[model samples]
Target: SKFGTIYFWRVHYNDSSDHVNETFSFRPVQPGGGGGGMGGA
Candidate 1:
């Protein structure tokens, strides 16, 4: 996967029935973006 590139994914399962999950998309952030941090609660 390339950084800053949009990616798409989905889940599928079958248990005596066929089903499809909602499609989702996300973009990869650059290294050391500094956006992930645990704030004081």
Candidate 2:
């Protein structure tokens, strides 16, 4: 796991009435390197 490395991940959660699952990919960034507040999202 290095800087700016992209990885695939899974997220499981409940949406109101039913169960939900999601898959996404995101890049890692250095702390305070760019815009703040959930920069990878």
Candidate 3:
């Protein structure tokens, strides 16, 4: 798996007219990417 990567998802409806949509994002962490493991190395 990759690290420090971001992913997004969205949905669209209708034929270029009125539509509903939503957006979301997230990132992956390597257990202790911020601290703890390996002295935050």
Candidate 4:
């Protein structure tokens, strides 16, 4: 990922009793610019 660039991700899970799915997004930050970038669910 590049600085200031937006990235997306998806998560999925399955079990005998349930199924789960989710989507998430976040932006990249510059190195040593602090912690991880902002994200949304």
Per-candidate TM-scores read 0.12, 0.13, 0.13, 0.13
The best candidate by lDDT is 2
Higher-ranked by lDDT: 3 or 4: 4
lDDT for every model? 0.22, 0.29, 0.24, 0.27
lDDT of 1: 0.22
Report the lDDT tens digits of candidate 4 across residue range 1-41: 32333322221222222233222212123232223442321
- Tens digit of lDDT per residue, candidate 2, span 1-41? 32222212222222222233222222233232233433453
Residue 16's lDDT within candidate 3 is 28
Indicate the residue-level lDDT of 39 in model 4.
34
**Candidate 3: residue pairs that collide:** none
Query: What's the residue-level lDDT of 39 in candidate 2?
Result: 46
**With candidate 2 superimposed using the best TM-score fit, by how many Å does residue 16's alpha carbon deviate from the native?**
8.9
Clashes of 2: 0
Candidate 3 per-residue lDDT over residues 1-41, each given as its tens digit = 22222111112122223232221112223332332332322
Residue 36 Cα positional deviation in candidate 1, in Å, after optimal superposition: 27
TM-score of 3: 0.13
